[model samples]
Target: MQQRVLWSAVMVAALVLAGCGSAARPASPSGGPQQEQRKLVVWDWKSGEAATATYVEKVKADFAGRHPGVTVEFVAQPFDQYYTLLGTAAQSRKGPDVMLFNGGGQIRDRVDSLLPLEQHVAQDRSRLAGWDAFTKDGKIYAAPVTLQGHPIYYNKTLYEKAGLDPANPPRTWDEFVRACSAVKKATGAACLALGNKEGFGIQFFMSGLGSGILTPQEYDDWIAGKRDWSSPHVRRIFELWKEAGDKGLNSDGANSTAMFTDVFRVFESGKAAHIIGLMSDVGHWKDFGEFLPPDKLGVMRAPVVTGGATPSLPYDGGIGYAVARWTKDPELAADLVHSLTSADALAAFSSAAGAISSDTTIDVSRAGPAVAAIVPEIRTGRPALHVALSAKTLDLMGRLSQQLLSGSATVDKAVEQLAAADRAG
Candidate 1:
């Protein structure tokens, strides 16, 4: 499944031992026979899910083959309960040797439990795309493994049926809205398949819009309570969403739809013309093969809102590998992370998962034409809102977006609620 990237800012305020300084090394494995029988445990939310277990098994087999002396224990955590289980285990100092750290709230709040990987990173800088998202106060805590950037996925047949030139996709917000409206009018297909059933979907849309519509400093100010959520930029985004809802351009049953299955199905069935999702979706075209013809399926950058100061920078999200601070074998943990994220491993993983690697050394062309076309956008230096805000602030914004989308609250009311939530936190 293609993962959605949200735009909540994750601020790093806590201080920790910098990798440049001498911190006591973790105790090595016991000597002799015990050392030779080392084992590493990994808890991954992505691997355990029914939808992705097959891919997980492949990763496990590959890792085991690469390290004959090492035994890998793979544990899958349900998406809804993964964090809670991780938190409980982390507090007990019994967390997995290596774990998958997500981009936003989870990483922000649990970073203190993670070991700094700057030492490992310095030795193998090629494993990461950029240190900004995984670094804190000059210390790198995680090694980014995959790159998932937001992009527009449109069905070609729907475009043509709506009188749009399938060869030409919209490049601006005005053109995008007009094209979507046209698709709705001509074919009665939803212009865009958006699932609001889970608040994450709405948050993802906000992040994509926030990326191009707000300045980095403005985002920081919003998170710091220096600026109000009722500002024109924030209001404009919500207004656009409201407009989309009114135009019947959004997925049917959006209020109650399951994001990956139901919402994406609209596009897959040719009942929707477009979807704004991770670039990874371009690789998993088989799921929506019926609706998207090979030649007609179009991939493009997310449209920039008119009058926005920032250029189009898509929201990025994916999992990174982080070692536990309390691990008994830090070097082995680092080695595992490095091996999994190595250029060779990345190529294999990307091939299996249909994902893009963060490693700059890898030739993205290996992922095929569709993914190759989208790599440049992922590498753009636009700031991610999720990488910029405090964890608590991000949670508040996500809840506020949900309230607005559900009609349980007005945009202005939601903004006021966010202000209160920010102050309370």
Candidate 2:
């Protein structure tokens, strides 16, 4: 694949460049050790956000205290161009010493350019819970800072207005459909707030509802890279996506809506009863809790569609930091990553940025009822289904998903394309 070829070529160039640089360093005429400059540049999209300011400051302070001589600079890039910029940096061997990454395929595809941080972060392994997302081939390339997962969030006020019991939510797919009908009939609100403009709705829907659609074996196999795109259950997922759109379960202009803050805003404004939301950062319990009463926000499991399916929480590392392999001091950079994931720093991040800290020891009981319901399921949660697919395949899926919504692409054709992509990889 393209990633493998790129990795091989990049690693070779990096090694050669590193070798030449080390050989070129001159020795002191008197044979005394020469002083070396200590500076580290870190890049991330979150650093510039207002909510993350305090968290970023805490991390910088902690890292500076631990590394007295090091001058650390944090470059905050726009999220839309983050990956493209990083790819260019990698190709040119001029990237930052440390950088942030989302877990799963994002970090996995770029592992060749990152220093494995397993040994460096061994001490905090027991305290953190999202390591699997940042690990590849038994090596940890990054330290997770937040736990992100899709949790079904509903508006209790909407439920009550629809003549449904706010105390109890639907437990099956049929029941969920019935509730949606009631919500639509009583209140003109849609059942779900869906935004697919960037093709993110299908990603959220697939992971958010996958636990309820696929059998345990099938689900595990998909995550393990043994996906069966033609499987009946897999087809069922696409069918449901189309069905939801055709039946008007989602709000108007679903395909034109954006996912990031817009999707959350729709749900927060009470335009829909349910949404597949995240556990941390933007579209989560904490964000919605600000608009709706904390008690009015409820979290529910994905309603079961297949007989053998069992709904468990779907999650992984939300975001993490990695040390670049080309850094002058890998250990020092890795140490900075460790500092970023420290308990105090993560706690500050969770508090100020509304993120679920990857550190399991952080208390989130006061976060709200939605978080309370989600945290308990983390122990049994599986990695999200979308996160397993490569970036190329994901992009393809997103495009196909749009056609599915508009009835331009049949489920069969979508599956065929996806199967071919998976096989090609």
Candidate 3:
């Protein structure tokens, strides 16, 4: 509800931001330089990272070549305050002309302030994947730069300590539990590395394991907003989430632990045997590979928990670039978004920053075994369950997840709250 309110606040406070836009100026005669040079600002969390230096450079180079008179400034905001800053900017009419956004509800809910990119990015439709994440009302609002997925990653050394074959991970929920149990008994390591301080743990947990719990059709329905929170399958997900904490599968102080680099460290340092990890950005194969041997980073599907449930990949469009509706030149901003997702620029992104380029055509065979494994499954992968939820519901889920972990809330109570939030959305 607070999220909805914040957006409503944006709509009310920034009425002019959405209502007015600068008209497109005619191109200079004989294709010469314009009378007035233009500048576009881009904001994102990734631009400041050392690994993304090449990605940023690539974007600037591509855009500069396309528009010599335009000056583009990159502002890398700290992610914790990203949305707050975005809201303030929208309200103040001082935000970037083009900005980065997470797919799903984050972008969808802000469409009142965004320019739809459907026609602008038509050429990229067939070349890139994960468009559904940034599309609402059949109109695309951004261009995806990377595809993100939750793949169960295990430490081969930890598997060996559990007396399990490193090459063959468990294929069923029962076997998975036994493996966790064995790891706990043999090495004193937590079975899984979990951090939920910000409630992101449950988000990863739902997406990472949802494939094994929900029937294929039910999974589709959930993504389509036909969620049945009280249904046995839906309730079962919450049940298992609680059960994992009760069983001591996750490391201690799980709720206090940050889900970002901290959770990845828990797995990298071998304090835990496994993690439900991302395909791109941090906490993934490349980040772990920097600390562990490439061969030791293993990717596995969600183990099946219910009869007839098929385990497949779950993912969404990671981060993407969007043009603001208030921009002086929507096409100019859209073109910058285009350059941001260009093949060469994204190829540099994949290799330089360890992101899985949304352009599936990019070869990742040499990235690592884990990525090699994840890429092949992208064709059949489904959007993550949490990604389908609205921002308000996600925040609610995060709180409920913590209560469930600490035995403070029953699965039923959590479901009821979520059902209400979902309906409100």
Candidate 2 minimal-lDDT segment of 10 residues: 23-32
Model 3 global lDDT (CA atoms, 0 to 1)? 0.89
Q: How do the predictions measure up, each by TM-score?
A: 0.80, 0.90, 0.90
Point out where model 1 deviates above 4 Å: 1-37, 47-68, 215-230, 281-291, 308-310, 366-369, 381-383, 386-399, 423-425
- Local distance difference test scores for all models: 0.66, 0.89, 0.89
Off by over 4 Å in 2: 1-37
Candidate 1 per-residue lDDT, tens place, 1-425, comes to 12322222112222233335334333333324324338888888666444455555555666667777788787777877888888778766776989987765567667778887888768667446744556666677778777655556788888888899877777678888899888888988887888766555656576666655666567657534475666787777677777677666788777777666677777777788887666442324434545455566677666767554555545444678888876777778887787667666666566655666676566766544456556666556454544455667666666666566666777777667665765665
Model 2 agreement with the true structure over 1-425: per-residue lDDT tens digits: 99999999999999988876432223222213334538889999988888888887888899888888788888999988999899888766677989999998899988877888889999989898889899999999999999999999999999999999988999899999999999989988899999999999999999999999999999999998899987999999999999999989998888889997788899999999999999887898888987999999998999999998999999999999998877777778888888899898899899888988898788988877777788789889999999988888899999999999998999999999999997887
Candidate 3 per-residue lDDT over residues 248-278, each given as its tens digit: 9899999999998698999999999999999
For candidate 1, give the lDDT: 0.66
lDDT score, candidate 2, position 107:
94
